[model samples]
Target: MTDPGLQPERTHLAWRRTALTFTVVAILAARHAADHPAALVLIAVAWLAFCGTAYTRGRTTTRPLPHLTPVVTVCSVLALAVAAVLVR
Candidate 1:
């Protein structure tokens, strides 16, 4: 059986992974945005903000912020999707 004590650690690790993924994606997007420098700047800024939030939330020992993480995640995803379409 899984140990309950490990759940929070797993969750934190998952968030860290997510932040890492976002960072990688941001780098790729920047490389692709050479023709659209303004958009690249905006995307990089947004991704950095989201990454910071996710990383911090993951490290917190207290309860998850009420509804904040999900909202930030969703907004970041939608922003990235829109940026992808526009950049293309």
Candidate 2:
């Protein structure tokens, strides 16, 4: 079997990629938010935190720390909700 750290490393990299995607979408939302800025703010907050969390998860060796995926998934859903609200 692979070293235990290997799975976390892969999960961390996935989170990083998720963070990148969120950042790009956040920027796009900001550019278009002149009429609806709230969504952009939410997106910015979620994405920035996501970036930080992913970075931390990648570096830390401690077990029992919160998993990055669920946190990210929650934030992503929130972001999506914000977008949906903005669209309506």
Prediction 2 TM-score vs. true:
0.62
Could you tell me which 10 consecutive residues in candidate 2 have the lowest summed lDDT?
57-66
The alpha-carbon RMSD values of the candidates against the true structure, listed in the order shown, are 3.7, 3.7
Per-residue lDDT over 1-88 for candidate 1, one digit per residue giving the tens place of the 0 to 100 score: 3346877788789988988889898888878876886667678777977988887887773666868878887877777776777688
Superposed model 2: Cα runs more than 4 Å off: 1-12, 61-64, 67-69
Lowest lDDT block of 10, candidate 1: 1-10
Clashes of 2: 0
User: Per-residue CA lDDT of candidate 2, range 1-88, in tens?
Assistant: 3356577677667767876887787677676765666776676677677777767766564544566657776876688578657956
Going through the candidates in order, what is the number of backbone clashes in each? Answer: 0, 0
TM-score of 1: 0.78
